[model samples]
Target: MKFDLHVHTRFSKDSDADIDAIILHAKKNGLDGFAVCDHDVTGGGPFSVQRAAELGSDLVIIPGVEISTSEGHLLVLGIKESIEPGLSPAETILRARAQDAVVILPHPFKLTSHGIGYIAGLDVDAVEVLNSRCLTDGPNNKACAAATSLGIAQVGGSDCHVPEMVGISYTEIDVQERSLDAVLDAIRQGKVRPGGGKTPKVFVMRQMMKNAQKRTAKILGLD
Candidate 1:
C-alpha cells in the first residue's frame, strides 16, 4: 500500500488544512493511506481517521505526530496520544518505542526545523530520504546518502501542510494486510521504498513563502 507518512492539519499551528479535504485529496491523488503527523499534536488523529473512513471507506489513517525535540523533528507513527516534545531526540525515540511506535528521522538535512543537525547514533527505524516539500533535491540527496552510509531503512513523505501536496512523496509499504500494525511492521522490517515525484515548484515555493511569513510573524510576536 502507498502511504504518505507525514502531513499536517488544522490542528498544527502552522497548518490550516481541513482534515476532510486532505483525505479527499489523498484519495483523488490515488494514495491508499497517509499519516497525519501534525507538529507537536495528535489531538486530530481520531477525528481524521474517523472522517476519512466515512469518506473513502477503505482508506487508512495511521495516527502519527511530528514532534519537535531538542535535536529537531521526528515523525512518531502508530501512536494514539501525543508524545511530549522538547525531550532530547534520544529520549524522544526511546519514549516512542515504549509505546511500540515507529520513529523516522524526517528531512534530516532540510535546515532548522526540518533538519535534525546530527543523528549519527540515534536509534530510529527509518530516515526520510525524500521530503517533497524540500526547496531542492540537494537536501533529499544528503538524507539518502546518510541513510545509505548508516545502513538504515529509508522512507519518504510529503511533510505537507496543504492538500495538493499530500502524496507528492510517499512510501510503498509491502504489506498485504493493510492494517495499522501491519504497516508499522512493514516499516520496521524495511519492507518499504520511497516513491512519488517532486512537488510542483510553484506549490513548494508557495509553502516556503508561507513558512517565511509565519516565522516573521513569530519573530514579531504577531502569531
Candidate 2:
C-alpha cells in the first residue's frame, strides 16, 4: 500500500488546506492512503477519514498527529487523543506507546528544528528517512543512518502543508489490510520502504514560510 504518512490540514494553525481538499488531492493522485498529522491536534483525523469513506475513494485515512517535542518533532499514528507538547521526546514516546500509537522520529537530522539527536538514546518505533522538505541530501542520509543504527523501521512522508505538494514522498508498505492497526504493524515489523527526493522550489518555499511564521510568532510574543 502506498501511504503519505505526514500531512497537515487546516486544523493546524499554519496550514490553510482543509480535510476535504487533502482527501480529494490524495484520491486524484492515485494514492491508497494518507495520514492527517496536524501539529498537536487530532481534530481533523476523523473528519478526513470519514469523508474518504463516504466518497468510496478507497483512500484510507490514518489518524495521526505531528507533535512538537522539546527536541524535535514526532509523528504519532493510530492515535485518537490529544498529546500536549513540551514533553521530552522520550516522555512523548512513552505516552504515545501507552496509547498503542506508533511513534515516528520526523526529520531528525534537519538543522532547523528539534531532531532525533535530541532524544537519541530513547527507543522509537520508526524514523522518517525521506522527508519531502529536507533541506539537503546530507540530513536525509543521516536520518537513514540513524534508523539503521537503531534497528528501527524507516518511512517517508511529504510533510506537506500545501495542496500541490501531496504525495511528493511516501511509504510503501506490503500490507494485506488497509486499516490503521495493520499499517502500524507493518511499520513496526519493518515492512515499509521510503521514496522521495527534494524539489528545489518546494524546499525553498517551505523554509521561507517557516521562517516567516517563526518571525511572526516572535513578534506576537507567541513563540
Candidate 3:
C-alpha cells in the first residue's frame, strides 16, 4: 500500500486545507491512504477518517500528529491521544511508544524546517527520507544515508500544508492487510520504501507566503 505519512489540515494553524478536499486530492493522486500529522494535534486524523467514510471513500486515514519537541519536529502515527508539544524528543517518543504509536523523524536535516539535525541515538521507528517539501535534495539524501547506516526503515511524505501537494511523496508499504495496524507494523518492520518527486518550489513558496501573511495578521490583530 502507498501512504503519504505526513500531511497537514486546517487543524494545523499554518494550514488551511480542509479534510474533505485533502481526501479527494489524495484519492485523485492515486494514494491508498494518508496520515494526517497536523502540527501538535491529532484530531485532524480521526476527523479526516470520519469524513472519508461520510464521503464513501475507501482511503485510510491514519491518526497522527506532528509534535513540536525541544529538539525539533517528530511524527507520531496511529496515536489516539494528543501528545503535548515542547517536550524533549526522547520524552515525546516515549509517550508515543506508550500508546504503541509509530514514531518517525521528519526532515531530520532540513535546518529551515526545524529539523532535529542528528539521527543517531534517537529511538524513532522510521525516518522520512523523501519529504516532498524539500526543495533541495541534500536534506533528503542525508536522511536516507543516515537511515541506511543505522538500518532503520526509511519513509516518505509530502509534508503538505496544501491540498494540491497531497501524495507528491509517499511510502510504499508491504502489507497484507489494509488496516491501520497492518500499515503501522509494516513501517515499524522496515517493510516500506520512499517514492515520488519533489513538491514544486512555486507551490511551496506560495504556502510559505500565506503562512507568513497569517502570522503577520495575527500579530497585528487583523486576523
Candidate 4:
C-alpha cells in the first residue's frame, strides 16, 4: 500500500495548512493513506482520521508527532499525547516506546538536525531513508546505510507542510490490514520500501521559501 507517513497541519508552529485541506489534497493526489504527524502534538489526528473516514476515502490517517530532540527530529507514530521537545533522542525514543509508538528518525543526515550518526547508539524502531524534504542525496544514502548496517527497517515520507507535496516521497508496505498496528509491524519486519529522491538545491530552496513565508505571516500576525 502507498502511505505518506510524515505530514504537518496548523497545529504545528511552522505550518498553516489545516487537516481538511491536507486530506483533500491527498485524496486528489490518489493516495491510499496518509499520516498527520504534527510537531510535538498528536491532537490533530482524531479529527483528521474522522474526516478521512467521512470522505469515503481509503485514507488511513495515522496519528503521529515529529519531536525535536537534542540530536535530531524524530517521528513518533501512534502516539496519544503531547511529547515535549528538547529531550535527548534516546530519552525521546524511550518515552515513545513506552507508549507503544513507533520511533523513526526523520531526515537523519540533514545538516539542521542531529543525524543518525549521533543517535545510532540509541534504540529506534525504523529509519526514514527517503524524506521528501531531505535536500541532499548524501543524507538519504546515509540513512539507507545506517538502516542497512543496523538491520533496521526503512521507511519514507513527504514531510509535507504544504498540501501539494504530499506523496512526493512515500512508503510502500506489505501488510494484510490497514491499521496502525499493521503499519508498525510492516516497519519492524522490514516490509517497507522508499520510492523517491531529492536534490540538495531544490530542498534548500524549498526550506528557504517556507521560512520566508512563515516569517512574513508572523510579521503580519496572520498565523
Show how many residue pairs clash in every candidate, following the order shown.
0, 3, 0, 1
Q: What lDDT would each prediction earn against the true structure?
A: 0.87, 0.81, 0.94, 0.78
Where does candidate 4 clash, by residue pair? 71-114
**The CA-based lDDT of model 3 is what?**
0.94
TM-score of each: 0.93, 0.89, 0.98, 0.87
Evaluated at residue 30, the lDDT of candidate 3 is: 92
Displacement of the residue 37 alpha carbon in candidate 4, Å: 1.4
Q: Which pairs in model 3 have colliding backbones?
A: none
Model 2 Cα lDDT, one tens digit per residue, 1-223: 8889989888887777767778888877667888889988898788887877787767888899989887778999989678899898889988998888888888888867556564257677778889887767887888888778777788898888776677788989889996778888888788999986564675558657786988899999999
Window of ten residues with lowest summed lDDT in model 1 = 111-120
lDDT of 4 at 28: 78
* TM-score: model 4 vs. ground truth: 0.87
Report the error of model 4 at residue 176, Å. 1.7
Order of candidate numbers by TM-score, starting with the best: 3, 1, 2, 4
Order of the predicted models by lDDT, top scorer first: 3, 1, 2, 4
Q: Kindly report which residue stretches of model 1 are placed more than 4 angstroms away from their true locations once superposed.
A: 215-223
On residues 134-218, what C-alpha lDDT tens digit does candidate 4 reach at each position? 6557888888897888887788888887777778788888887978788777776778887854434565477678888989999
Q: How close is candidate 3 to the true structure, as a TM-score?
A: 0.98
> What's model 1's TM-score?
0.93
